[model samples]
Target: MDLPALPKPITVDLSRAALIVVDMQNDFCAEGGWLHSIGVDLSPLASAIEALETLVPAVRSAEVPIIWLNWGNRPDQANIPPGLARVYDPDGRGEGIGATMANGSKVLTKGSWGAELISALTAAPNDLHVDKYRMSGFWDTALDSILRNLRVDTLFLSGINSDQCVYSTLTDAASLGYDVVLVDGASATTSPQYCHEATLYNTRQCYGFSTTARDLQTAVSAYPDTCKERS
Candidate 1:
């Protein structure tokens, strides 16, 4: 199928395509979660949820795989480097990853409420789930192996912190030779507006093309009749 995207329109084979939703988890997106508990405004990240609501089902209906890549750190956090640990708790406060939030959930720890996907989004039983420790999901995660097993060559990226985790994963996917598409509406960031714009610009200029959720939906809707035939 031909997807209308920035930098140019590109054709994608549904059989070799998958959708990766990154860090749409509660820690980064929900109120009372990690970022919110630390006083970061969540309004910017919330925009991606609405877009994902429509885009997810549309992509699923077309038989495309939905891969949820979220932060699910070890409880001990032994694998976390000092530099990364300082990102969340620069002053040696106890309010970093693995810290308990006001709601009684440990921030981003595996099996913690804060590490789970937002309640608004549902993961289908057969969908893929990957736990990531770093901004780049490819590092120390099974994401790349799973994509390879599925024989996916094209990835549709969406999720929170467009300038950070989402961008990091996209960059790695491109470096690994996978065709990537950043779904603008389905991805957002808590960073400044300029940061988000820079991410989009960099994606189109260096990494891969980008398209709106609506355009992606339109493209997927055009291919329903061929879903079973493709994969």
Candidate 2:
């Protein structure tokens, strides 16, 4: 069968491009933390992380920064919305996500869990972690300053809740004038179809472009010398 045509070719300035990984915590991606009851699965989360694993070396080789974006918040039920309560409330005992993934990396927490990255994908030495309070990564977060400090001109976006957090991040990133690439497969929502469609729609409309983690890995390998910032 013929595959769909690839999107327009876009190159991230290795020295100025950064990978912004949104919430990949157990509550969001694992089998039983919070939203799993709603059908959130670990398959895509693992797949995305695996893709990052394959692409990290490439990013490191090119000197581009790999950032891990997480969420952390006070242990208060009032913080969570009524609709999201059944999934992430204190009753759910959701604080383990961040603690589970804590390691040698810059940590950023948002909400109560601080938008924790999954335990399966811990941060590396060169990784920068940022905690966000709102939907967008740039909203009162150190993300913008860090990007500016790194002279980053492009952002490779991925993570949980494709229709919410990921979408919000992409929108903000685009408005900020940074070249953005949304990894459709690297992200998953409570609903797989919704996540997929959201990624496509947002990429084709608001974001600069979209691709899968595998394809991005291929792109990185093609330009092996393009992302060597980690080592």
Candidate 3:
């Protein structure tokens, strides 16, 4: 099947844009948790981290705030949908993957693994982190308030599991009127087709555009004065 062609080269207004990293957690990306149960390879975790290495410095130099949205679930299934909670033992305490995320960025835990950010990725002091109970980052989470506080109008999204959490958060962000960007190569899924298909369908259609980290970097380098013009 032919994949969608890249959209036109676009530059966002840096002064009003922010980078939103979604549920790139160990449970989904590493050897433990639900995703591994289905035989998914998390080597993409490394790819995502590499993408961040190329993109983060550029976004940071542009003064775009980096936001990490992680999960913090409760022992009881009270916070999540009953159907989701019932899939696993509510009281079970399982260790995910091998290590915790060392990204020095501000960290937020959603669902249960409040301190872990997928066991990989770089962290920086200025990064913003928030914990979410549900799939949507805006649902009962500090994400909205943080974005508002930063005066962010554009959200550049990256992270794991394209069909579930990432897709859910992007849809929610679009409905709220924020300009969105999906860093295409910075995300992955247990199913490669799932990731690619989700981005082609919903990205830019309901939310904003889908771009690669490299393309964004180049645009930023070529148009460093973006804040002076419309995105």
Best lDDT among the predictions, by candidate number:
1
What value of lDDT does candidate 3 attain over all alpha carbons?
0.66
Lowest lDDT 10-residue stretch of candidate 3: 98-107
Give the 10-residue window scoring lowest on summed lDDT in candidate 1. Answer: 222-231
TM-score computed on alpha carbons, candidate 3: 0.77
Task: Give per-residue CA lDDT, model 1, range 1-231, as digits (tens).
Answer: 888899999988988999999998888888889998899988986678998988898899888999999999999999998778766688979888788888899989999999999989999998999999999999999999999999999999999889999999999999999999999989998889899899999999999999999999999988858454655
Report the error of model 3 at residue 8, Å: 3.2
TM-scores, all models, native as reference: 0.97, 0.74, 0.77
Query: On a 0 to 100 scale, what is the lDDT of residue 109 in model 3?
Result: 30
Error of 3 at 199 (Å): 2.7
TM-score-best of 2 and 3: 3
Model 2 residue runs over 4 Å out of place are 1-6, 37-46, 76-116, 224-231
TM-score of candidate 2 to 2 decimals: 0.74
Query: RMSDs, each prediction?
Result: 1.1, 6.2, 6.2
Q: Local distance difference test, per candidate?
A: 0.91, 0.64, 0.66
Clashes per candidate (backbone, < 3 Å): 0, 33, 18
**Candidate 2 residue-wise lDDT, 188-231, digit = tens:** 66556766685777577756788777777666656544345432
- Model 3 residue 166 CA deviation (Å) reads 1.2
Q: Across residues 66-110, which tens digit of lDDT does each residue of candidate 3 receive?
A: 888877664443566644543323443332222233432111233
